[model samples]
Target: MWDKERRSVATVFATHGAASGTFASRLPWLSDHLQLSAGKLGIALLMTSIGAITTMPFAGRAVARFGTGTVARTLICVNVAVLVAAAWMPSLLTLAACTIVMGAVAGTSDMAMNAQGILVEKRLGRSIMSGLHGTWSTGVLVAAMAGSLAAHQHIDARVHFAIAAAVLAVAVTWGTRSFRTTAADVGLAAEKKEDVPLFVIPRGVILLIGLVGFCGIYAEVASQDWSSVYMHRVLHGDEAEAAFTTGMFAFTMAAGRLSGDAVVGRLGAATTVRACGVLGALGGILVIAARSPLPAVAGFMLIGIGVSVVVPLAFAAAGHAGPNPTMGVAGVATIAYGAGMAAPGIIGGVADLTSLRVAFCAVAVLAGMVALGGGLLGRNAPAALHGAEPVRVAEAEVLATEG
Candidate 1:
């Protein structure tokens, strides 16, 4: 059972990783094919983010009704189809439509997988969530490398996407059989009833954690989406160098997450979180103040390391807070993702009004706040107030006995 569960989680991670990789590789092709100006491209990308925000809450509900596995498989299929269509389509309207559809599917998959991970962590009786997320980072690494290779070989975006889709299809096939049904876990239902509020409101510690997550995700998104542009436009880097900047950030992030569990185990969540926040803030400051490309790239790497564990830690904290951890996680995730979508555009708008350098400096200020907020969160410890019955142990025992 454990093996099956492990494999199932791994498959989902791989699918997401591959898709992200393929998407990054295909962006240049997308730009060239559509002849999109930077402004137009930004607008189109914003639509995709809007689709994600619009669909994620609904996806959480779907996971509540249908099973995580069902939703995951369905969304993967949809993602593949939409991505393929988007790859082939040359028209801006068609591309926008396809990108929105892909975003919706991706959002659904994201919710379902995390909900599933929550369940899996309950069963395994230890911290597997970070490792699962690490797998996602690993997947992105592989995908980026693979996509770059394909591009270098002159493979068209359509062919690359088709290949990625094939890989996802195989993974989905293997994962579905081991997928847990909602009916399989009565305890989770009871817990949900107990933990979830009648009115969905973010308050107390959960709200604090969500805000922290918001800052972490905002920093991450900024680096992922804009670092390359910054390198190219501000630092006068070539396309290859710009791409390398993004890749290095992702690589370091993956490394941090892969090792995050150990750090958490050694330092405990409170201390680990505070330390990471400080590191991230410092990294952001360094990046903003950097005069040359090398320093900027180094700053991004530091940012990656600092922000790496924030999301997983936040999710774990959220799950531990409420009896119905899925609801808690979903709520926090919704806020965090919404923040992520808004970060780039907000930063871009600020950049347009002022300068890109100033915009990044603003981000640094926010990152410092995030770090301090994380420390404040540690001091308050709302996870304790949610009725400290050793939730992790109780949840694990329930899974073991139920299974």
Candidate 2:
């Protein structure tokens, strides 16, 4: 019984997830096709992060100028093209170039779609962000599975990407029709009056919120990338057991997100986030202290559920924290994405220096930070930002930073 606009925006989220997941699931093939050494491939892959971080600063401006629907729809389609181009690249250099464009388009579209989701949540006057994010996770899972199947069939990566591009392009174009701008969404455009900078570094409350999101994303990224390795290496689990541990984490994460709106509705965002932080911290502790595989598996599952809704709620908070919803979202996204990219390396470095248990202590500390900082998100928000209209950035805040 969802409305057209809400359904359409969800479609946008799903399609974007699918596009990114499709590329991700086929990366092994891509590396082999280009005959890249592991070291060279890592460098090529780093281009995606470089591209995303470099261009994210302008995403808010793009959305303001072009409208959320236009930017989201166009960039998602472009991302598909970039994926196809990447699949067909002749050499490591070409692949790196293609990945950079892939990341830029994908990151901008992500910010734009998030802005649109906030708009939809505003119009609906209830919690939907978590559900939208869950839909995105579902899209990623499904696309990844499909890519695995295609790879199993030995389908050429070139054909695989081209077909995926054609299908995803059509889906995104049709899905974004309702996301187009109208008079109602013009409030986001109103920020132009303040001479807002193209890229406003998050300050004060926004930065605090971003840091809260960072803690959550750090836990999430660390768990997603390292849980299986931890299982096999630290817990001495078999390969199947290690894979199962990863799957368990993914399942709980998706389940938690899908059910998070109801939880937020009942407990309120602030309380839910605080509880999530504590739970995540507890999970991190269990991981650090576990000497057996079962404890570690349970710990990862807890971490999954603990952090599932944190990012969605953070974005929701961001939309209301600043005069420009898009900018607020972009600022938060920039911080959160940086955390995602950094978590793996940081954890690995710590593990190299000491042990995986020691590396996970970092996750525990950050999760504890989330618990302490959780109050900042809700202190200024009214009614937990549920059904609240976007507010003007505080005059003091604007003067302190935007000036």
Candidate 3:
């Protein structure tokens, strides 16, 4: 069985996932309610990316000052409230405003939870970050399916979102009760003295590791945005077939994440990430050359598995890479999340100029970059620097007793 702190953090991750998934699954209904065109809806959705990108640079400072638990609990409530408000928006302008707040809360909470996960992993003296992320993906899958069913039954968006908000709020309250409330509480007081910039930016080894994760995020976002389009337009697949390919990518990505920790333990983080990058690159090649829907589906699934653990592993690496884990994480995430926002435009623009196939060449090259930068995630620094040195037995005992 999982320990209290670990399970609690996992619940936080799950609820956050559900909150994000709810918006995506119910987007069509929101679009219909607002009477939005494809262009208008696209613009409204872009507000979310803008909000998240702008807010992420400051997330580390928030965590450093307030502690992960406080930041997470506060933001989870704010994020849920924002999502519920979005369900009631009477105009595109109102909904777009809600989305910006929704995105900022969601992104910052994401950073806080992962910071907590790093602490949990350190306490346990093992690799649990991947498993924590796997639970997040699972939460998304479950929530997406439920939202889809609610929409199919013509349930009111207000009712659905309200119910979701109430449930998540209650769950988060219970789950965060065990969270350690300060850096000193977790034996990380020394890390607080390290210089963390007011604005997060990748520098030194952190930049290199962030670049590796950036490639993975770029590929992941590109596939999520384009796999269905590629299936329908390129292979002339029917709607069901196109949806199936997209489903395949999502399913394999989730499955691979669930199993990633064990794989990391066996092969080590560097080798596993390197291999995953190679696999993603191969998958990209197959997608570019694929003439049939079947091949495209296979390729997308490969891409899914290939990129599944990259972000989790990257977060783990960044957590200990500098004197301040929170700022190190913020810096890496700024770069990596930028890739997520950029992938769609870059790929779409390239496809417009040439072809989608040619555009994916960028993804393939980025995947290869993951392999090249994989070595940067090698072993941690010394204990004095908050590296991956084994947690003192006494410190672990103190944590358990305090909980």
Candidate 4:
């Protein structure tokens, strides 16, 4: 059982994370191939967000109906196919259409995988979400490294995407096959008795978590979409070297998340997230000010490290937000990812209206929101869910035993 759960956690993260890396690293090239202006590019990107938002409401129900393992395995393959197809899309219209389907396919599968990770975390009775999330960062890191080298070598986008699809497909297939039986597969029979919305706007405590999650997602997606463009266009970086921006960001993000469990254990979620917010802000500022590619790389790395654990913490909170972890996760994902995707549209408009640096200033403000949003978890109710307890409680139990 333990082994199966471990495999579920690892493979589920790999499928989407790797694909995200592939897409992000290749986005500038995709845009160039389509001959898109900044505004047109934003519109294209918005279509993907639209598809994801529409599909997320069904995420909870799918996990309840089909089981997380099956859902994750099936949709992950679909996501890979979309990436492959995207490389060959001939027109802006076709790529926009492809992104919509791609977003929907990837979003639902990611939701299921997250559900699986939560279930496993519950059984282990420790904080594994951060580590599971770290695996996702590792996937992104690997994809970015591969894609960077490919782009630097002037590899055709279609050939590059095809190679990535084949690699991820094999790894995901093998990984999913190793899955252990999970509670998600067992069923949500009793959970059906309660009234739950297919999609919700998150209220009260959960709303705060969702907003912070939004900030995290906003920073991440905005960076993914624009950071490379910023370097290539603004700093006059070599097209090949521009690919390294996403790679650098993903590398630091993976590094931070891989070590996140230890940091969270020591500082707890609230304090840890606050620190990350600070890092994100500083990183954004550095990127805005840096005149050269190397400095921009350093800035991106800082942003990566700072924003690394925000979503993991948000997902951890969402997992315990209500009786049905799936519903809560779905609700928060709706708010965060939905809003996160929307920001880039406005940013694209702004970029067209002014400059990319100005658009990124908007991103820095969102990062500040992450810092301020950390206070919402001040009550630390979620900590109890992860099995944290006071030292005094242990002392009391010991003294009672002595008595």
Candidate 5:
């Protein structure tokens, strides 16, 4: 029932969403094939994070210079191509280089596609942000499952990713047709120099929204990487049993997002996000206290549902937050992605020093902050932001950090 624009943007979201999980899901095979030690493999994997952190901050300018569809489509091709080739990497160093390239492409594509999602959300005039994000979560689950199947069947990683690449190519060709440029994009590229800002530091409520997203981003990525480890090492779960932890989180996260729009309509984004914070906090605490794999899985389910819609809604707010939607989204995405990339290292370091339980407790504190600071998201959100002549940034976030 979605129109062309909405469907096109949704495809972009799906592709972007699948990139991280697909690559990540293949890690075991890749490491074994390359004979990479744990430490070496970790360093190699860092290439993607480095690429993302380095390139994402600059994506706003590219999105402004080119239409979101143009940027997204171009990057999707690059992403798919890189992913396919990266799987064929014969040496450790080469794989690291391949991963770096994939990271750059995926990072830029993430920003562009999210920008497209904002455009579509504006066109719809309702809270469809959660649904769009749900699509991404679904893609992640699908690709992860596919990777697992391929691994189990002992299929070549090259064959698996090449097939994925071919499908994405088809998706890009069909899916990018209706992702047209928005008015905000035109204004950004137009003659009004005063309307454009030199740097996009989200102002007022937007900054708070970004902060809220920061908490979720950190928790989301860290949990994905560490949950299984905690179950295996901390709770003495077997291999298959520990793996179920990730599945539990993924399934519940997807379900939460699929139901998120209705929840947002009923309770509003502000309230929904606030509630997510409380739930995440409780889940983290539960995980810490859980002595068995089953209770730990249950706790992760709560954590998954709690953080599911937080980042999506935050991106929606940022897209419509400032005078320039692209830049606003860029600012928030940059902050959140950076936090997410660092979270694993921080949490792991804490686990090394103390234990996994202690590291998880820290996440609970951040979630509590999200609940405490929930008021900042919509303090001045006007009735409608989709077609507003000149959009305004969140005033509170900007002023609080003012020089």
Candidate 6:
């Protein structure tokens, strides 16, 4: 049963990852095919992000009522349908509209899968969230590679998305049955009959955690959506080199998450987060200040490594923060995601007004703030505050008996 559940979780992660990769990979082609100027493309892309933010809160409700399997399957189908529409659209406006729909589906799928992952982690009683996220990164890498290969072979973007959709469809079909039928409560409520609070406004510690996530996500989204363009246009790197920068970011992020559990266990979440934030800040600064493309690319790698563990740690903190873990998790995630969605447009506007390099420097400042915030947060919460009273108690008893 455990094996089956793990497999299902892995499948969902992979499917969502592939979908994200396909969307990202198709963007360059979409821009060229539609003859979109950079500013116009930026505005159009904002619609997709708006769609995601608008839909994510509702996705939480859907998961509460319909179950993760149903939500995942339905959203996956909707995503494919939207991709098809996007592929066939003749005008930039039409494509932008399709992008909005695609974003909605993608956002819903992300929430459902994350909710499912949290549940699975509870049942297994260990740290699986980072690993599940790593799988998503793996899928993104695979799709990016596939898209690159197909483009090199002179394959059309539509065909590439279609094939990617087919892969996701198969994954959804196979993993549908193993998804949890009931939502898993992570000791959030005292009674089984109590439904998880769907609309609690996060306060106190939850709010702080959400802010941490907001900063981290803002940095990450900026990198994901703009780093390639920055590399190509600002650094004068070739197409492949530009793509490699994004790939390197993704790769380092995945590597960080894959190894995060051990690091978190050894260093503790507070210390680890502080370190990551500092590293990310340094990386962002490096990207902004680098003289050559190689250093800029290396900066991306540093940012990836630094920001990798922030989200998972934030999520874990949210889960452990309040009595209703789901609501807390949802609140933080929703805020973080909303912030993430807005970041690109904000940065794009900044670039329009100033320069891309200056805009990235601003992002570096934000990343530095995040690091400072993490340190402050760590001081307030500490390891003793992470709901680990029993460990303290056990240690106390051992000391007393030994004495």
RMSD, every candidate, angstroms: 4.0, 6.8, 4.1, 5.2, 7.1, 5.9
Name the candidate that leads on TM-score: 4
Q: TM-scores, in order shown?
A: 0.85, 0.79, 0.82, 0.91, 0.82, 0.86
lDDT of 4 by residue, 1-403 (tens): 4556576668669667999888878777887998888778887788878988999878887877766767878888888898999888898888888888887888788777776766655545556677778889888878877877888888988999998888888777777764433353433224552254655566887777888899998998888767777788788886667778888888888888888877877787778788988999999999889888888889888888888888877877787666676776777788787668776677778889998888889767788788888865444334533337421234454345235
Structure candidate 2, residue pairs in collision: none
lDDT of 5 at 235: 88
Clashes per prediction?
0, 0, 0, 1, 8, 0
Report the candidate with higher lDDT, 1 versus 5. 5
TM-score-wise, the better of 2 and 6 is 6
Model 2: residues with Cα > 4 Å off, grouped in runs: 27-42, 89-94, 151-159, 180-183, 186-196, 224-248, 282-300, 344-361, 380-403
Candidate 6 Cα RMSD after full superposition onto the native fold (Å):
5.9
Candidate 2 vs candidate 6: the lDDT winner is 2
Q: Could you tell which candidate, 1 or 2, scores higher by lDDT? A: 2
What does candidate 5's lDDT look like per residue over 12-91, in tens digits? 77777666556655665665678765445555656766777777777777776676778888887888888888778888
Task: Kindly report which residue stretches of model 6 are placed more than 4 angstroms away from their true locations once superposed.
Answer: 183-200, 323-325, 375-403
Please provide, for model 2 over 1-403, each residue's C-alpha lDDT reduced to its tens digit, 9 standing for 90 to 100. 1377788988888888778667756655665577654446555655766777788878887887888889988999999998888887898888889977876788788889998887666545567888888777666656666666776677887898899899989999998888745224523234452354687577877788888888888888677656756776688775446545655666677778888888777777787788888888888999989999988988888887888888888888887775567788888878876545456556666666677898889888888788787776665444534434434444564345323
Top candidate when judged by lDDT against the true structure: 4
Give the Cα lDDT of each candidate. 0.69, 0.74, 0.75, 0.77, 0.71, 0.70
Candidate with better lDDT, 2 vs 4 = 4
**What is the C-alpha lDDT profile of model 1 across 1-403, one tens digit per residue?**
5567777877787687667656754565576678865445555566667777777656545776677788888888788777777888767777778877777787678767777776766554456666777777777667766665666677887988888888877877677667774423634544333333433455777777888888888888777667766776678876556656777777877888888766665666666666777777777888888889999989888888878877777777776676656666667766776556666666667766776787777567666666676653344323322223223545566557556
Poorly placed runs, candidate 5 (over 4 Å): 31-42, 88-95, 184-199, 202-204, 228-244, 351-358, 380-403
Residue pairs in collision within model 6: none
Residues 21-40 of candidate 6 have per-residue lDDT tens digits of 66665566776788765666
Candidate 4 lDDT for residue 10? 82
lDDT of 3 at 340: 65
